[model samples]
Each structure stands twice: as structure tokens, then as C-alpha cells.
Target chain A: MHVPVLKQGDYLIASVQSVLSDADLVQLRDDLAERVGQFRSRGVIIDVTVLDVIDSFATRTLRAVAHMLKLRGAETVIVGIQPDVAFAMVQLGLTLEGVGTALDLEEGLAYLDRLARKPVKHGK
Target chain B: MENNEACVSINSAADIVTARQKGRALALELGFDGSDLTLIATAISEVARNIVNHAKSGEIVVSPMNHSNKRGILVVARDEGPGIKDIAKAMQYGYSTNKGLGVGLPGAKWLMDEFDIESKVGKGTTVTMKKWLH
Candidate 1:
């Protein structure tokens, strides 16, 4: 499945519309990381609205991808998770902890924008 | 009694996607609504992924069923791989032997109305799940 990752300003928006396999997911992770570097993006919005199923592996991969992007100085937001998919994920205990989530792509982009506006504090 | 039974083989990640799509199509044909269809499809994906990740090969059977005044769909995923040594432990949340999230089995169970598991050590594992058309 082809996943289009488009750069808008300083944020990268990836709309995932395919039923991804393990290899495809791995490739996406690598691809997104590379894009983040090449584009010098400060945030990413991953849209999964079209997916009917978000299995355990996919959930984990998303979480891992978000974590990786965070390490690369980019904030990540997941949007468009269907209600049934959310129910199954929670029931199965795949809470996708520590990952930022929004209701839709618009909200995701806005959330990232808000994050970008926050003043950076040096050192904890 | 099994009727309108369909089966799909699982050997790779691509097969998992196919099995879930087939499950969703079968459930849709059985008059399952959107939520029910997603639930069934997600359940199928979990079990089929297990076959690819742990078993290396397996089969998923989807069938329409009727009992009393109720109608539903049945899904059976069977894999001949290294069987689960501790079924109970494996069913617990966040318990994964393969360094995974350990939610496949238990999560699948929660997605369906009825769930059953059968496995033998050093043999294989079989999971049967059903979702009623409500």
C-alpha cells in the first residue's frame, strides 16, 4: 500500500490508507524518520482514518514511530482512529501510552501548531 | 453446524491483511453492522498475525451460523507452531513471550462474543471466535 507523506510548512502529514504488513510498517517507520530529517519538520500528523483494523503490531509500530520522531525533535500526533478500533485497542490493553492523539487531521495539525508555539526551556 | 464456510491461509503479514478483509466481507454479507464488522475484522487480524509472527503458517476459517433465534459469524484460526506453554499467562495483558505487546490473544477474545482456545505444547494452537449480529 502506498502511504503518502506530505510536508506542509514545518510539519509532515502522513495519511495511512493501506492495510500494512510488518515489512511495510518497518519501511514506513524508516521512511518517516528519513522524511523528518530531510524536511527538517518540527511535527508529524499520522492519519489512520481509513483503517478498519489496528492490530497489536500496528499499534506498537505507531507508538515506536512516534517515539522515534520525538527523539528526532519532531512532535507526532495520531488522528482519525475509528471508535471500534479504539474500543478494541483499549480492551486488548494496547493503550498506545505516551502517544499524542487527536480526533482528526485538522485537530492534529492545530495541536502541533500549538506545541510549536510554546517557548522552549533549556535543561530540565 | 457450519454453513457458508470460507477459509484463508496465513503465512505472511500480507496474508493477515487478506484474512481480515475476508472476515470483514463475510461479516458484512452476514448483515453485520459497521462496528461489528470492524470488531470481527480486527479480531481476525490479531489471530492471523500470531500465525505469521509465531507459527509461520496457519489457516483462518470464516463461517455463518445460526442458533436458536440468533445469527452470527464464526472465525477459527489454527496454527501448527510452538504452542503456548502457559495459556493463562499468555492471555494476560502485556505478557508477550515473543517480545511483543502480548495483546493479540486477549484482545481478540474481547472483540468477539464467544472465544475459545486450544493448544498443545510443541504442537500448535487453535483459536475460535464468534460475533453475533445484533
Candidate 2:
């Protein structure tokens, strides 16, 4: 299952197109982290609408992805978690806490845009 | 018995995906709804992952069943690897010796209607879970 990461302006969009295995999830994390620097991306949007189940492994790997992007001075937003998947995640105690999430691709882009419009933190 | 059963071997992380996908497909054919299908699929993923992570290899078996006219899906994950030293500790939430969230087993239990596990030190482990079509 390949997750295609597309570069859009200063943001990156990685849309999951199929059921991803553990190896695939790790590959995605590394791929995005590398692209964030190679492309000098400011934000990332991961579309998971195609995913039917996001279990513990997937959740942890995604958290790692977001954390890695943040360390590289890039923000990450996960979008398109189905309602049933969300309910299962909640029951499994797999809340994507500390990670930004939006309803879909449009909201994710809007969120990133709003963050970009704000003044840079600190005195920089 | 014609099309009510399926089995997938769990070896690598890739097998986890296969097992869960097959589980979801079987569950759907068994008349499980949207959320229930997701729940069953997630539960299978967790158990199958355990087989790969700890046992190195195993298998997941899923089948449709009936409990007094109440249809349900049964999932059984079996592996012959280093058994859990403390099943209780392993089942507890947030308890993990491996580099994981430690919620795989417990979370899987929460997602299913019925859950059971058996293990022996230095022997192996088997996890059986069920989800009713509700």
C-alpha cells in the first residue's frame, strides 16, 4: 500500500490510498520526513479516508510522523478519519492526542493556512 | 460452511494488514454493519500484530457463527512463541515491554463483544475474540 505524498506550494499532502501494513506506515513516516526537508514544506496534510481501520500500531506510527515533522519545523494535520473508525479508536483508547486533525482535506488546508497567517512565535 | 470461514497466516507486519483486511471482508459477509466491521477489523489487527511482534509467526482464523439466532463473528489468533510471563500485566492498559502503546490487547478486547486469552510460559499463546452483529 503506497501513500502518495504530493507537494502543494509550501505544504505537503500524503493521501493513503489503501490498507497499509506496519512496514508501509514506517515507510510513510520516513518518506514524509525526508520530503518535508527536501521540499522545505511548511505544513503537511495526511488524508486517511481510505483507511478502514487505524489501530494502535498505525496510531503510534502517525504520532511519530507528526512529531518528526514538528521537529523539522513543519506542522502536520491528519484528516478524514471515518466516524466508525473514530468510534473504534476512541474505544481502543487510541486518541491521536497532541496531533492536529481536521474533517477532511479542505479543512486541513484551511487550518494550515490559518496557522501560517498568524505571526511567527518567539522573537524571530 | 460454504463461505463462512477464512484464515490468514501472520508472519511479517504485512501479514497483519492481510489478516485484518480478510477479517473485515469476512465480517461484512456475515452481516456486520459499518462501525462493527471497523471494530472487528481493528481487533484482528491488534491480535495479529502481537503474533508477529512477539511470536515471530502465527495465524488468524475468522468465521461466522450463530448464538441462538444472534449471528456473530469469531476471531482466533494462535501462535507458538515465548508465552506471556504475566498475562494479567500484559492485558493491563498502558503496560508494555515492547516499544508500543501497550493498548493492543486491551484495546482489542474493548472493541469486541467477547474476548479470551490463553498462554503458557515458554509454550505459546492463543487469543479468541468475538463480535456480535448488533
Candidate 3:
């Protein structure tokens, strides 16, 4: 069972738990992407804290979420990445690239707040 | 010899984690980077998952090797079960007989420098993978 920890505001929080397999990682990304479209103005914070391992599939899914949110005029920040897990990700040569990574829920919210204020840079 | 002295076994998922931890430790002890250790762990996890789902019981052997001018980590995944019939097809990504996403053996082979698969229809399968550190 995989649950995504999400934050709506500084204090408002919600958990989206799903039984995910390798394929479901992709599904979850799509689901989150759709959610971003519906709640772009509110911004979004996704808690991937429960994830201990980041494989190619998971990385791709996360990348998709990041792109989708960006398209919907919103910003997404990932939080609670464990150290050993980060080390594993580094070893895999996996890159978050455009996605933001935070230390915890508080940090993630803070990161999102900061992004909300920054002027959008158009890739023209 | 330093090569023969390195060995370990994993039966369950917990054992898989322990085995991978030990494998990474060995990789570090032999001067490999943490990145290599991650790939090794992923590869081992895939094989161990296969053991649990298919073989039900198997043993993994991790040994150090001096291959050419670089140090290589040799992993032998042995299992006693219904062996693989088509080695070529099995090596293809997304070609799992079981309902896997099909990124286990093929992915492991891609991550390593050398991969060899030997199996008999009714016997078992032995996969040997070696990752060379430069």
C-alpha cells in the first residue's frame, strides 16, 4: 500500500493512499497531474515520504507529475526524502531535474510558498 | 584469496535487504562507489523477488573478482525451480513469464558489465553478473 502525503495549506493536510505496483506508479502520476489541473491556483505539495526506494519507474512517474503541474500553471514540491534513499537515487543516476525536493512537510510547504511568488519563467 | 572469501545468502525479503546491505558493504570495502552499490542492490532485489515468487527457496552468492585490470563484483543467483526455456526471450525487457513489469533480469543485465544465464529445462537457472569498477 502506497499513500501520498499532501498538504493544502500550512496546517491543512490530506493523504491519498493507493495500492501501487510498478505500473501504478505511472497511474498515480497521472492522477496527481489531473489533480494539479483542478487545483492550480492553490498550488500543491506532495509527500513522497513513505517511499524508501526510487527506481526508474518511480522517477519517471515523478517527472511526469512535475511536468504536468508545470503545465497546469502550478508548482509541485516533494517532501520527506530519506538520506539512504537519496543515496540510492544518486547511485541510480536519477535526477529530479525540474522537480523540487524538500526535507519534510514543513519545508515542502515553504518551498511551494516561495515558488508561488517567483515570476514564471517562460521557455520561449 | 580476497575473491573467494566474500560470500552471503538471502532467503526472505528481510534477508534480501541484509544481503544487499552486506553486498554494498563489500563493494565499498573493495573500493566501489555508493552508486555502484545502489545498482547492485536493485539487481539483487530483482533476483531475490524472483526467488520468492517463483523458486520459493534459493541462495545468492556474492564474491569479489579481479577481472582484467579492474575490480569486478560477481553475483551468482542460483535457484531450483522450473528453469527458463528461452534464454533469449527471457533476456528481453517486458518478457516476464510471471506478471512482473518485466524489468528484473533484463534491467540487471543492463546495469552490469557482464551477464550470463545458464539453465536446464527441468533443473534450475544460474545467472552470473559482474560489474567492473574503474
Candidate 4:
């Protein structure tokens, strides 16, 4: 019911370990907060490849995770969403517009790295 | 493939997959290819799930498109339960009033050619979706 994979480094990386259930989704939200509560990072990447379905509760948690991380000066990225899952989302009219997404874990990490390296623009 | 086919019924979430399978079979028998049949089935499943999660109970109607191409499938799902009071807010990417990924309606809209949703507070919700077979 609970299997999480998180990357270690300047960024916090987490992945859902199994089928997402109503309870697991809630736990993930809490775990995300507890894990990144003290870390000073640029972003967090959550791999969702193993998840076959995303229900309303799960969506809410994802949004919460993003919000919590943002408050800590970090962004959230969701990766590896399956086609059926993606289709289901659209049918239900779900969108992750503000959150970052990648095709897989590698690309997600790269995206985070890219965001981390972006130079801040300021008036000279 | 005759256009004189229609089936409507109300079922629970446990029956959703079987209902979708039946719908896809009906579409295939009516000359829709595998891909398009799958699309219709998937859309039906998503919307039906919405009925179960949000409305609690509903009916699903599947009919053939009555157009010149004769290559379209129409699905209408209606639920006589707590209707969606805020369509615009529910349509947002991360705005889910229930416990889900909030991707169902938007994703279903993407799978088909046309999609429409109508609902009222304390009345019910109706979702009409159509997919053209190529």
C-alpha cells in the first residue's frame, strides 16, 4: 500500500510505489510535508508511473503536495503518468497546468536540474 | 452497421467496467473499429466513474451518430443526484471537490471529438460525449 522512491540531493524526489488508494494518497501528502519540511531545495519530483488510477482524493493530495513544497521554496513535478490514467483525468477534466511534468524519471530529473540552473534576471 | 441501436441503464461503480465493455461491444458490432470503440468505452468509463463518485447514481445511454459519415458514436450519461453547482470551478486542472486526480472530465474531453456537460445544484448532471471513428 505504501512504497515511495525519493531522490536524494539538492532536490527532494519521491515516487508512488503502488496502486494509489484513498488512504495512500492522504499519507503521501503528509509524507511530502514531513520529508521536505526542513530541506532547502529547488523542487520535488514525484514519479507516478506505477499508479494506474488517480481519483479525486489523490488529485487533491497532489495539489496539496505542490502547495506545501512551494511554501518551502520548492516546486513539484509529477512524472510517468500512464495513457489510461491520463485519459481518465481528461475525461474527469483534471489538469496539472501549474505543476511540472515529464515522460519519465530521467527527464523529470533533467527538468528539475534545468529549473535549478535557470539564471535569475534582474535589472543591472 | 445499423443505426437503429440504443441502450440505456443505471449501474454502480462495480458495474462500470462491464458496462463499458458492453458499450464497446455494441459500438464494434455497429462497425466502429477497435481504436474508436476503445475511445468510446474509455470515455464512458470515465464519465460513469464521475457519476459514481460525485452523483452516486446515474444512467448511461449509447447511440450511434446520425451523420453522413456514419462513423461517430454518441454517449450520454445522466445522474439524478447532487448536481455540480460550479461547472467552471470543477473544470479547472486542480480543482476537485471530491477525492480524485481531477483529470477525468478534461481527459475524457481530449479522447473524443466533442464533449458537453450540464448540471444544476441538487438536481443532477448530464454528460454527452461523441467520438468519430477514423
Could you give candidate 3's per-residue lDDT for residues B1-53 as a string of tens digits? Answer: 47343455555545555556566677777778756776776676667666666
- Of the candidates shown, which would achieve the greatest lDDT relative to the real structure? 2
Residue B49, model 1: Cα distance from true site in angstroms: 1.1
Docking class of 3: incorrect
Residue A18, candidate 4: Cα error in Å is 5.5
lDDT of 1 by residue, A46-82 (tens): 9999888888898999999999999999999999999
| Each candidate's DockQ | 0.68, 0.89, 0.12, 0.15
Cα deviation at A43, candidate 2, in Å, is 0.3
Model no. 3, DockQ: 0.12
Per-residue CA lDDT of model 2 for A21-117, tens digit only, reads: 8888999999999999998889999999999999999999999999999999888999999999999999999988889999999999999997745
User: What is the DockQ score, from 0 to 1, of model 2?
Assistant: 0.89
Q: Can you give the lDDT of residue B18 in candidate 1?
A: 87
Per-residue lDDT for B1-134 in model 1, tens only? 34467899998888988899888988988899877887888889889988888899999999998889999999999989998898999888778878998888988998899999999998999999988877
Q: Which ranking of candidates, highest DockQ first? A: 2, 1, 4, 3
Off by over 4 Å in 2: A118-124
Candidate 4 lDDT tens digits, A5-103 = 464686777777765544566777777777776665677889889765554445656877887777877778898987867765655555676778889
Per-model C-alpha lDDT, please?
Answer: 0.88, 0.92, 0.67, 0.72
Q: Chain B TM-score in candidate 2, rounded to 2 decimals?
A: 0.96
Ranking by TM-score: 2, 1, 3, 4
